[model samples]
Structure formats: C-alpha cells, structure tokens
Target: MADEETKAELREQFTEAFEGADYPVSNPMDLVPALPDGPGTRFEAGDVSFTAMELSTKLSDIQDFPYDDVETLVDDLIVGLDEKDML
Candidate 1:
C-alpha cells in the first residue's frame, strides 16, 4: 500500500507534468491514445495536450508496482458514465 505522503507527491508530479500539455474536451467517449509501453491516456483538450503517463508512472512507482489498473478503472468509469447518460 502507498502512504499518503507518497501519493500526494506523485499526484503533484503528475499534475505538473500534464499541466504543460493540452487537455481533451470533457467528452466521455473521447478515445485517447495510450502511451508507449506505458499505462496512460494522451489527448488534446482545447489548446492543451497532455499525456497521463506521468500520473500512471508516479502511482506505480509509489506503489512499487509494474502493472496498473488503469484499464479496469477506465472501464468502470465508462460504465458509470453510460449509466448516467454521460457517454
């Protein structure tokens, strides 16, 4: 399990890295590209584009993990969105 401090640090790092890129429109159906051999989503939002790899990497690193649950999480999110008519 990851401690709170480590998680916070990772979150900060991830936000910093992604803040430099464009974000995708708030579309639930948007299909973001995956990072190379990494667990992340890349998309363009307005004038800012971002890669979510940093967040994945940070979380994995803090947990000392090599695998991520991103796919599962995304699937769950999609299901939830669909149920709520957000997708």
Candidate 2:
C-alpha cells in the first residue's frame, strides 16, 4: 500500500494533469487531449508509474464516464489505482 504522503503526491500530480479536461467528459478519449504529452503523459510516485494510456486502458472498468468535474474523475482514478494495488 502507498503511504499517505505518496498517495497525496500522486493525487496532486493526477489533479494537475487531469484538471485540464473539458468537464462532463463522456468517454475515456476525452481525457487524452487534456494530458500534457497526450496519451504518453507519465505519472510516477514511489515504485508506481503509468502513462495516461495505461491508466485509461488498465482502469477502464473502474472509470465512470460523463465525469462532471476534474475532482470526481481524479478521485475515481486514485481509487482505482488503490484498488488495483498500484498506489
């Protein structure tokens, strides 16, 4: 399990990157454009690192589309990472 500090750092990174998406995104592809390096954007903390593409594909089932805001989307992403033992 990731420590609180590590998780917090990861969350910050995710929020900063993902917050650029136009809200109310209806699908995973909507997030790709918001990424700094598109799908290649990589997020890392401790021993965990994954590209935006990997996050989208690997956690697809955990993601609920039509996200109303960045906060909710980021929350789900972090929760998915935790549930998958990746954070």
Candidate models: Cα lDDT each: 0.35, 0.90
Would you estimate the TM-scores of all the predictions?
0.31, 0.95
Q: For residues 11-72, what per-residue lDDT tens digits would candidate 1 score against the true structure?
A: 44434433332244232122223233233454333233334543333333233222133433
**Candidate 2 colliding pairs:** none
* Model 2 agreement with the true structure over 1-87: per-residue lDDT tens digits: 999888888899989998989888999898888889999999998888999999998899999998999999989998999999887
Candidate 1 residues lying further than 4 Å off, grouped into runs, are 25-87
Ten residues in sequence with the least summed lDDT for candidate 1: 25-34
Candidate whose lDDT is highest: 2
